[model samples]
Target: MSRDAASRPARERLLDAAGELFYESGIAATGVDAVLARARVSPATLYAHFSGKDGLVAANLERRFRQWRDVWDEVLDERTDPVDRLLSVFDAVVRYRAVEGNRRGCAFLAAAVELPPGHPGRQWLAADSRLLTERLHDLAEAAGAGDPTGIADGLLALYDGALARLARQAATPGLDTGDPLHRARRMAADWLAGRVPPGRPSG
Candidate 1:
């Protein structure tokens, strides 16, 4: 791993640098040279620890996934009710997005759009999707929803849609929109209560 790639601190430093860049900037927009420059490591060092840019991206994603999982678990842990645990997912999302100067949207979803299906980082993105939806599924099952699967799918869709809209600053031509995240959270709550939010007509 570039001679000292086996060193714990060096590897961490490299990863930290890559993580910052990858999250703040699009993965494809960020290059190995930029990462190396930021990490203050040589090409051999990064290559030794990771195969290349894709490898670094995958590793960075793994770290991000762990961070997100921990947050999700914490948010759910604070709520005793099954329904609260499910709703807390959206709470956590909003909290993360509210962080100062952090406009970078869902890193996994962003990467999913950029990375092809065969890319190594794509696995992490797929895992992310599965973990999120599975958590919702578990919560729905605990809450005894008759259509737990459908609810889970719908909630996940709303969550991702919010992230996408937030990424683009809610900007769309010929369409007026309020805060996308606010609407998503409200809609999730309504769904949890077996109702639909106002203006979103029920079929």
Candidate 2:
């Protein structure tokens, strides 16, 4: 039987295995052999589903992007206020951090840095980041911001910085850094109130 025919669910199995391994262990550290072994599939099976390791990495990144979109959609769906919708993104991140086994940094971001510049996964990362920024811009416009693009970019920068800080602080055990989302929300409120610049303000 052909590899595809032999492994009826090869594609899904490969994706699931890759996601688990890639997220737990950095992409550079996880090799094709390790993925194949975890999935209990032969090299030919993997090749049949994905052209190569790059293809597999692309698929994994796409899967993660989809997952992130779904999570945002679920959280933002019930929010009618655009400003609340915009701030809710940070809320979701904070809630995610509170969850058990919640790693501080984003898996997609980690993978994107590890992958080569021309890699397919890099395209996915770029697209995903754009999607997020656009969504935030829409919210900012709805919230009556004079410059939605600028406001959205500022919010994105804050979100990224908070995530980075949270990850760095994760090294300490049982130490809660309070709620980064709350801090983000207060910061957004200040920006909206004209008390602070949308981006980092001068001291």
Candidate 3:
């Protein structure tokens, strides 16, 4: 931890340390001792703030979800057109990645994959997924889709695929991950314009 970081509250430092480590390294792969060392906090301090590693994991996931939500909401708020508002999610991602320094992909998706069904972190994961699904449904309805549920689901699938592609690109060397989010957004716009059907074959 830097001197500036060392000046922060123990909980804040711990969460920052845990968030970076858990996202950059898999949650299972990153141990609590690593987080403690990174934060420059003692085991007792971590326990005092988070109760344990599970609580810290849940806190970090919740923080990530809130960060994403705030970015998405800011982008959406800047648009007036319904379609523009819906598509602003891609714009939000551009800003989010820049601001968060997130190169791997979706943190919520990672947590969902890493944590088990009964894990505490699963609640935040479920909340993040639910927010995406419900918000997309609302946005699709606003955009005058014939079937909001179907449109929302299709868009959700596109978003998830984009995130997975990003992760794959980050993991592989010399991989040609050609603008997955942009491609997804274009497909969405085409579908909305009736230029293409959902699940159209890719050339």
Candidate maximizing TM-score: 3
In the predicted model 3, the residue pairs found to clash are none
Candidate 1 lDDT, 1-203, residue by residue in tens: 34455444756877877877877777888888888887777888887898888888888888878777777787777787666676777887766656424564577877878898798887788788889888888777677677778878988888888888776763345444676778998888876775222232111
- Once fitted onto the true fold, the runs of candidate 3 whose alpha carbons sit more than 4 angstroms away are 195-203
lDDT minimum window of 10 residues, candidate 2: 194-203
What do the candidate models score in CA lDDT, each in turn? 0.75, 0.75, 0.83
Whichever of 2 and 3 has more lDDT, that candidate is: 3
Provide the TM-score for each candidate, comma-separated.
Answer: 0.82, 0.81, 0.92
Q: Please state the error at residue 120 of candidate 3 in Å.
A: 0.9
Local accuracy of candidate 2 as per-residue lDDT tens digits, 1-203: 34654475878878878887887778999999999977778899898988899999999889877766767777787676556677878876655445425665777667767998799889889978888799888777766677889988888888877766666656567878776657867887666666223443111
The predicted structure with the larger TM-score, 1 or 3, is 3
Q: What is the C-alpha lDDT profile of model 3 across 84-190, one tens digit per residue?
A: 76677778887899999888878888887889878888888888888888987887766666787887788788888988898998898899759788998998777
Model 2 misses residue 196 by how many Å? 12
Regarding TM-score, does 2 or 3 come out ahead?
Answer: 3
Candidates ranked by lDDT, best first?
Answer: 3, 2, 1
In model 3, which range of ten residues has the least summed lDDT?
194-203
- lDDT winner, 1 or 3: 3
